[model samples]
Target chain A: MDTILFLFSLFVLALFLGVELITKVPPTLHTPLMAGANAISGITIVGAILAAGADTSSTLVHALGFIAVTMATLNVVGGYLVTNRMLAMFKRKS
Target chain B: MNITIVNLAYLLAAVLFILGIKGLTRPKTAVRGNMLSATGMLIAVVVTLLDRSILTYDFIVAGLVVGGVIGAVMALKVKMTAMPQMVALLNGSGGGASLGLAAASYLQSLERADFGTGAIAVLAVFFVAVTVIIGAVTLTGSLVAFAKLQEIIPGKPLGFAGMRYLNGVLFLASLAGLAMLIANPGNTPLFWLTVAVAAVLGLTLVLPIGGADMPVVIALLNSYSGIAAAAAGFIMGNTVLIIAGSLVGTSGLILTKIMCVAMNRSLTNVLFGVMGEVG
Candidate 1:
């Protein structure tokens, strides 16, 4: 199969799956869910790492890559930690 | 070190990401889900570094350490009341990363004379252009949304005469720039011009959105960043990126829809109404 065509199919499947996954989440959890999803968006860190480390010869590319890596790491680390903090408050009393 | 092994690792990471989102559906599993997703990210980063034989580990290590510390401190210290703003800023950072990656890729390609004049090259340029525009827009737009939510900028709708008309013009200009980019992939000047216009478009589009609509705006921008990353993945032929990006895009869109519904406003109204101030 063509790679792009396969990617589009995967994209459509993920779309439906995403809606199905979150449809039942209550409003009270919306903030934490959003935070959690924000953390997931930090998946760009993968791309950033590749870009930053792919070529060390070009200073400009290196700078861009380094910045990307730093910003993405911040997103991933901060996002997860904050989501965990928020979810901690939602726990039921023992 | 084998290519197939790296691909398999990426595939595994993608599955972990999906499971992470699924876990978030329930409060009891939300924290675990977050961890699952973070683990997935770690796996992906490590695999990319080892598989690609990246020559510069020092910069990457420095970025991770500094960024991790800052993120941890912010997460630990931020108030719940500021959670929305924090999410907005995090989303912005992801968008910033996408923009940075796209820019780096473009510059590197230019240096290597990789932008060959072929159908495939045009298609690759199209994806890169999409990445640049969407990534830039998401970065600035999310920042504006963050400022509004943070109350650093006024939360009231800031409209000027014929703002909608101006936005329309800017949107059309970006499309024109995109067409130019596809026609000639080596046109770096045109590419940066398009990105700059898109950045302004993002600012104008979000400036008039009031504070009440910030949550929806943030969610929508989150989707934008995901779509931008997906475009970057297309350019790089990275399957895991495409999968993870689409997952975030779809989930963010769903969340935006839910927020709109919760606010009793349609998506169109939230975006175009610009009348969110309630006495």
Candidate 2:
């Protein structure tokens, strides 16, 4: 319970910090930043990889983990590449 | 690697992630910002692999290769006009990944009978159930949003005569499923049933929303995905996941709020207003 509380505290603090940081973004870059931020959401891939490789897990767990990894990879890889693409367009225009 | 070292690496990665987001305040550094975040992700993944708990790599290697290739192809091929659609798709996959992880984690805990005692055990079950619900909702909601944006479905509001009542019922069912899972303690929990209900709920909830409101919907789902990941982090007791997930969670919320302002609608209206009739 203490651990949960600690983690929860971290979650809340990070959330506030995120709001503070993101508000600084100008409206012009909203879409690109949104894409970039979505890519960061792919951080779930960490959980997916851990689940996929757990020694005590069953075949079902492994299978689910496999799919999770694939999905998360798409989020990270597809997300970042496309975000970069969008940002590049902005750069070219400026 | 030592536990301390692994955790330290995770901390460094989290710092990089924060820096990455901070960089987005200006366009001059935005692209580099994304690269920094990606680099942080690479560090996290590589370090996670070195943890001694994993015994084999076949599934990991195969999944990375396949997912990586497909992701690259889609990213490269998609037109800029289709960027929003691509973002929606990728965001959905992130949610799907969280759902899968939560399910797997729940099952693994059951197999090991590792649910601890007292507040910890109760909290564990709570987090797991919430993670599944939120994750499933994000995945399907984003998909429906994607379909609408891509013109795979009509972009206009599409709701049945009794959608409100049905949505109410489904929402209640989701709550009931959650309550049952938390109350039962053990033995064949209704995980899949809960998943199905939430899935349908996502489909129904987003269908009534018009295409013009998609930015709000996508932003909201992106927030959901991040929260799901954070809840999953609770299940695993991983601090890094918790931090990163919450960062995305709130970041997405800000984006949603900004979109709402741009559309001149309150969040509630965007979420549950009377379709084209509301605005």
Candidate 3:
């Protein structure tokens, strides 16, 4: 329980700090920063995957975990790719 | 099982969840919303761990240690440029966790001698299976949105000729899978196939959405995650989880609305809207 609490608080803190940073930082960096945070969220994905294999129930847990894994993976892929693409716009215009 | 204390805990958590969502309505008070929601989650987790059969101490300690360390590191080390990606990933994980819990609860039910042998039991299994499919698809789809935002791959929208037709087919297939599961939930293969189809549908749904509209996608996905959690809570008969998850689900939907305003776009513009305009 404490662990989940901690994780939850951590997420809140990240968002709090995120809003603050976005305000202070220039607009050019917005996409990249968001992408990075999205990647970190993958930790939860890992935890979920592990939980799937935990001692509770196998079939349901495994299935759920598989779904979570799939979702998190897509998030990582899509977020990073988009951030990079946005950053690419900063290249010197001819 | 005396449930007075647990019920009260859930009631309190639900109140906090409501407060948190109210707070999240505006940027100025968003932090308060986050704090309130976090508090609600804390209450929920503690109450869940209080179950007599949980064997709490060791696992609880380990969970805190590992989760705390990673969370701390993430909070301190990650730069702002990566915040959105992080949000996407974290949101994806939350969705996944909810899905996993639902699945675990179902599996436990199936293993029970009383439940593994009847038509009613099959209905229960079907609910669990359908929940898993929706939850899984939501999870994967959110991740894909995250990836598009971060530019790990092309951020350009990917669409095929007859894309709408394809999506339509997938939707129908998902529904069929649901019907099949409900009719014969004991068939594990059928359940698995449903999950697989749902996942592919998730992938398909997000594929054509361009990078520019990802914030909206993220918000929408957050709502989906919350709904999944709520379903899990129902399956497990966990009052706290249900309340907290519903709070998140509703709040996410509201947030998505605000985000659309910020972008000067409508929800329709966000989904099918982005496709009409090319990079």
Candidate 4:
């Protein structure tokens, strides 16, 4: 219950913070911003690792956990690398 | 070993993630922002491993290696023009992970006979159902978005007669399934059925959206994946997952709104206007 309440507060705060953070960004940077945000969503990789590593006797859990870990890792690695690539192009030539 | 220390580390990781996003507001710091967030992820992963003793590390290691290789290759080889589709694909994989995690949790609960009786059980079942529905929808919707963006499918609204009505009906049925699952948390059949229906609903929802709407759709799906992860966090009682999920969810929503503004469309219109058609 306390956790849920805390999480709700966090959600509201993050929403406002996100809006504040991105409002100043130029339209041209939106693509890279979107890409960067996609990488952030890969935070689920943490949850996936927990799932895969959870102590359990069920083979089904193990299988699902393995698959989740793989997919989430892909999201994390691919998302960050791709965002970096896009940002590289966006950087002004020195 | 120490739960308190583990949680404290998670808190630190969450703070780093926030700083990472803050850094992204400027172009100069964006790359560093990405690295900071990745470091946060690394910290979270390592801390989780330290907190738990696994029966086997084989699957986890194998998954990391395989997924890492594929992701690196895709990131390196994909063209800038194709970045949108690649992002969509990555978003879909996140959704896929959520779906798998939610299912695994449900299975674990069943195995352990942990479906406590009464209101608590109902809440547990509700969270699991929400995770599965959103996760499944995100997975398929993202794939459809990718297909449209990639030209694998026509980049136009694809709808038939009564399509909207069919979608409404399926959505209602899924809601009814949720009600049933809550009433009886042990109903595995109902749970799977709801998942199947939700997957179909996801496909139907995105199929009618055109290529021009891919960015918004992808952003929206990214938010769905985050919400799904948050629900999974509730099921697992993990504070970091909750914080990270909310961050992603809120950020994705903001991005979707930005996309809508850039396109000069409202969220409702982007979702329901069925581009390339009059209505």
For candidate 3, write residues A1-94 as lDDT tens digits. 3433443453344334323322232334333333333332222332333334345544444554455444544443343334334344444321
Candidate 1 chain B worst ten-residue window by lDDT = B270-279
Index of the highest-TM-score prediction: 2
**Which segments of model 4 are wrong by more than 4 Å?**
A1-16, A92-94, B272-279
For model 3, the superposed segments whose C-alpha errors exceed 4 Å read A1-94, B55-68, B113-123, B269-276
Q: Residue by residue across A1-94, what tens digits does model 4's lDDT show?
A: 5665676676667656655655566666677777776777777777777778877988889999999889988998998899888878878543
Q: What digit string (tens of lDDT, one per residue) describes model 2 on residues B1-279?
A: 788988998888898889898887688888888888889988998999898877777777777888899999999999999888789999999989989988988888889888888778778888888888888888998999899889999888888767867878887898888888777647354878888898888888888887888878888888888888888888888888888888989988888888778777678755653455421
- Candidate 2 at A86: error in angstroms? 0.4
CAPRI quality band, candidate 4? medium
Q: In model 4 chain B, which range of ten residues has the least summed lDDT? A: B270-279
List the candidates' TM-scores in order: 0.94, 0.95, 0.71, 0.93
| Candidate 2 displacement at residue B113 in angstroms | 1.7
lDDT of 4 by residue, B1-279 (tens): 688988888888888878877667677788888788778888888887776555567778988898889999999999989999999999999888889888888888888889676766877888889888988988999999899888898888888756767778878988999999888778889989999999998888888777887888898888788788777877777877777787778777887887888887668755543343421
Per-residue CA lDDT of candidate 1, range B1-279, in tens?
A: 789988899889888988888888787787788888888988888888785557778778888888889889998999888989898999889888888888898888888888665666777788888888888888898899899888898998887757878888888999899999888777888988999998998888888888888888888888888888778887777888888888888888888888888878678755553445631
Candidate 2 chain B — worst ten consecutive residues by lDDT sum?
B270-279
Best by DockQ: 2
Q: TM-score of A-chain in each prediction?
A: 0.87, 0.91, 0.60, 0.85
Report the C-alpha displacement of residue B134, candidate 4, in angstroms. 0.8
Stretches of candidate 2 exceeding 4 Å from the true structure:
B187-189, B277-279
Model 4 clash pairs are none
